[model samples]
Target: MQEWWRSAVIYQVYPRSYQDTTGNGVGDLAGITRRLDHIAALGVDCIWLSPFFASPQADMGYDISDYLSVDPLFGDMADFDALIAGAHEHGLKVIVDQVLSHTSDQHAWFKQSRSSRTNDKADWYVWADPQPDGSPPNNWPSNFGGPAWEFDPQRGQYYLQNFLAAQPDLNFHNPDVADAILETCKFWLDRGLDGFRLDTVNYYFHDQQLRSNPPSQTKQKEILTEVYGMQEHVYNKTRPENLGFLARLRALTDQYDDIMMVGEVGEEGRRSIEIMGEYTAGSARLHMAYSFAMLSDDFSAAHLRDCIEGFQTGAPDGHPYWSFSNHDVVRHVSRWGAHAVSEESMARLTCAMLMSFEGTIGIYQGEELGQTETELVYEELTDPPAIRFWPGVKGRDGCRTPMVWEKHAPNAGFSTSKPWLPVKAPQATRAVDQQGADGIMAHYKEMIAYRKSNPALSRGKTTFITLPEPLLAFTRTAEEQTLTCIFNLSADQHIVSLKTKAKVALGEAVSLEDDKLTLAGNGYAYLSHGAEVPL
Candidate 1:
């Protein structure tokens, strides 16, 4: 039987800002349990929780110190069990973020490895000796900033960290490390987790020779950071050995029934989609993978078409997951500024476009509420990237603000006390309570139900319709149904000329008219032919 994730819509929840029941200014498992009803109402098949494992908080929860246990700040094992049970009771699957590519400096394995060169766990992490001049071993730079290699005087060598220096990259070259990580994953799978969102899945391996990365002749685009992506990032990550490790992960997941794994490919440009293809090429590897290609500032129809078509060509048989927004980057509405007509229009159109794709869909929390990006001042900044490279880059804190439950409540009902990140008034206005009638939230729920009700939209084969710029048109066909989805990805009115004859279903319900299909700025319409096209 096909797995649940094949056509599922997974909602991502950033735990730190979800809801704080303990009044600790941080969201916990108990808080998540209390809010299960809200997620269930969104009609998502699964919930992808950002890292809640024990960490030093250098990179928030991404720098995991312990993978097998839950952090005290989030909750204990019992709380996790309760959350999972509540999610299941509400007919929702649970998927947690697993940072296997790296570990906190405080982790037992890393601590032991850093103590001495001859320790049993010494090779558990990527470590290399400095050159004769005491310089770092390679030209590879960390994703955060500076050199990827950090000096460890105790071992008289340098350790590699794709991210922050405090979070050291694991050496998958060591079979023991791979075994240990697999054991950690099995622990959760046995405990009833539906699956995992593999963090930095492509950064699992590095060059064995620790060679220097060659510089790219291309000019750097400072979208997120200045440290990484300045060069081609050849030898730093996406190594061939990573594929073998992914196969190992897939094998571990296969041991359990109905479990799945989605990897986060952090490569640059179209390379991310290609890596997603490679990682999920076979049944013995990742079940699905997603990249930052669609999560960028680009909102042009041509860009979207090119991205999907590129993936289709690269991984003809490989499964891919499509998402425009997540916890890592700016929200799509604000990122694509001029293209966004109104929050309501963009929210509906974005969901319509995502559901029409031929892959699994991921929707970030508060997206259903039509939440916009929250502006934060320098003093309120918590993200390291924003703090270090202020002004040039606005950082991710804008997109990581707390969820809004009640407009009148303190901290927008996220917590009684102040949140880790402030929830702005504009975001508060779009609270769940406020979206009670004819609101964006209601529209989202309706769209989700509509997609679920129509098999053609849920699990149909997609074929792109060649259209002009700012207008995206595609047809999704199943055995007995054919649905045409059209979107105007701009702030100006656009028209889609249909050369063939077809009746529009759900016309009155969704404001879509007959043969002449007219779309307002950032508008979208779902049209269906009574009969499916013969394959």
Candidate 2:
């Protein structure tokens, strides 16, 4: 089989918000099956579904309770089988989210392990003795809030929880735990899964010594959205031993044909890009990996260039998957709107930039419509962190709202009844049916088609061209084609002199005259040129 993922575009489906066929106010497997055509029409090679597995709904299915079964809230086994079959029939590979780093407190394995000091699975999870004063094992803080260790009175110890207290970190230091998780992965592979979107891939292992983490040197203004960022996370996660487990997981997937895994590097800054490079450094680890580098609020040319170039320099042998939005964070259109003339223009510019990047790409649900973040109040909040932190952190529920399909239909055609997350007027106004023939959706389709048709854009090596602020330029060179991509990142128009003659292959508000290229606010140009020519 070929390495199709190297150039593939994957569409992420937040199942709970995609479509609701059950009339139960939530999206399910059958809902996804019925919506396969919608995704296929977008020309994405694969659909990466967030977790629909058996869970207590804590952390929105990330805290898996059963590795081999589906949650009743989503559907039964038959529904999943039908959804998989439907996706394949539409020429789309189906990959499900796999949360291997941790499990729900209700999982049978965690229950058994916590029941006794010496049960058969006692060491399946990371557990430690308390300090002399009954404090947590160390100073590690949970990504959500508070201490990272939860007191387990039954076991008379504290368990490591990098995220919510309900989601306990697994002990990969124990070989048995690794073997068991691998077997769980095999169960899905046997059922004909395309691959997996490994959740928190770098958190699979922790320092065995349980040493306290040192204070982060990060500037106070640059701290992340959680207390966890206050320290340099050395002992709790991203350990060196994580690579071995990734290799083993890769070995499992290699047994199946045409399978690929894309891991989520749950990190930030240059370290996030570095971890992405490390995780996907070779065929022995993840097929490709993505980081939060592009998901941040930084909208400058220097920041974007640093992210792409950082990955290239860090791991020349590794591959990357890039995205501007996902289930997490605010939508790109709203987050970067300040830098654009309009939300629609920002949407068009980001699409063009993302499609031209030299790697696999992913687009979240509703992204094609230039969807903006939902303005929600405290009463409508569902995300754990937002609920706990309140006004300090608005959380991700805004972006996880239902997909608006019909302009006038109830709940915007997402469901017959109300959705778990409200579909407000601002978001509903941008419904799929309301989009014009030449609108944002059409632009997305056009950009995706353009990327796929051009060999240089799809399968090319990237070489950045030094440019001043507000101007980003790069060349994608494939054996058959070479294209120079230039973008005006600001809301004001700019003109640049081209060094060589070129034809405009694709662009907006852009004109080529003589040797001058004029780009409007948020405009971009893809200029076709010869490899021998420099522009």
Candidate 3:
């Protein structure tokens, strides 16, 4: 039971975008409870709910005004309790998103902290005096834009905010602050919450020295709108002090029965993997961790191999959590469709590929329906990043559209009234009612069943098999079971020569000939080298 999450498939549901039950054009806990059967039908083991805590909608609930209470937009505490009980009755674990890095400016803690220098919680947040020239204490840039420091005239100092001005970073250096946050965590656990998905897990701590980070040495032809991306992020986040906090968090969670914690490592490339390893390297820290490596646009054989191998090399004792689609980035189909023959083929391919990875897996709400990103104009933008830099940077709103349950239903069955974000016609076209016998839906169910039947795919040791471009091959072994997984990541068909032994166990576009394997565009196969196929 303790290792249930190790092989569990977690389905992520964005709070506002999932389903609207109150007809208020926003998703509430009761809405999610109503959709429990839908998630259970998809064969996922658990549901990861996005932030629904009390907020001013300043980052769409990521800025927590009250960690202990659910926002009215998503219903009240009783609704949340009912949601947990509902999910539990349906044999599903509920993982809540805990945004601990910062609190909303309106939060009592922040309000009191920013009230005056002598306030009880004045040092609770990261505040510093203005430089001699009356500028920010450091040169840290916000992830949104401008300086990471916001001038608070009430306190006569600047407070660090890695994100928006409304979200002031917590000063983790204070022991009381960390203990208070953990106490809030205990409040949830005592309420029967299973675990937590720590948001911005690496941003829990900042450099106490208030040093400025140097510019990134690696230059690219393309520029990122997130100014924070241009810097190396040395001083702002991913500090060494974060480890101790994680250990404390783990200690807190260990008090509960079979509780799991997954940290979101927001760093990029191998560095993220390194942090992922460190965060989950032992039982004293995180249970597992995920990074942007698999979420980025670099979908290649080498890229996948390097990410897996990097984690294995860095922290051999660590477990990993992989997800190709979440609330943050663009949907995988929208981002990588160009490489496939069609969107459907790409969807099936990604599902098969991700399910085969030797780690816990997460699938976003509409990913099972092969949802694509919605196209929005300037007037329709809700996400701050999209509003700030239009045209050049299309922000996360495209991927956060409401889930379409019925093709003919008004607003695609998301709500009786208009939903928060407009649902695109293309996304609505793949609604659940219309997809009763749809191939992609069938494929997802079948793939999930296959993964559950085969222990090797979920709890195996992955060994990369060298092959030419676009042909990603790896062997996963567990006990006496060994399976060969192969995928053609591009639109072009490929034929590979296979020596020794293996048979196509699960998938389409897989043809076994006289020691030759043929795969069409976006094709994948799980080959069983064991005595017999388990399912």
Q: Which scores higher on lDDT, 1 or 3?
A: 3
| Model 1 regions lying over 4 Å from their true place | 217-219, 222-227, 506-515, 530-535
Q: How does model 2 score by TM-score?
A: 0.98
Best by lDDT: 2
Model 2 per-residue lDDT tens digits across residues 361-477: 999999999999998999999999999988889999999999999989999999999799999999999999988889888888888998999999999999998878799999999
Candidate order by lDDT, highest to lowest? 2, 3, 1
Compared with the true structure, what per-residue lDDT tens digits does model 1 show for residues 1-535?
Answer: 5599998999999998899989989999999999999999888899999999989899999999989888999999999999999999999999999999999999999999999999999899998988999999989988777888899988999999887889999998898999999999999998999999999888888889888888876787654557566678778789899899888888888888889999999975677878888888868888999999999878888888878888888888888899989988888877777777676777777877887788899999888888888989999999887898897778889999999999999998999998999988999998988987777888778878888888888888878877788878778888978887777888887655555455666421134344456677877767765422222
By TM-score, the candidates rank as 2, 3, 1
Candidate 3 per-residue lDDT, tens place, 9-123, comes to 9999998988898898887888899889988888889999999999998899999999999899999999999999999999999999999999999999999998888878988
Ten-residue stretch with the least lDDT total in model 1: 506-515
Compute each candidate's TM-score over C-alphas. Answer: 0.96, 0.98, 0.98
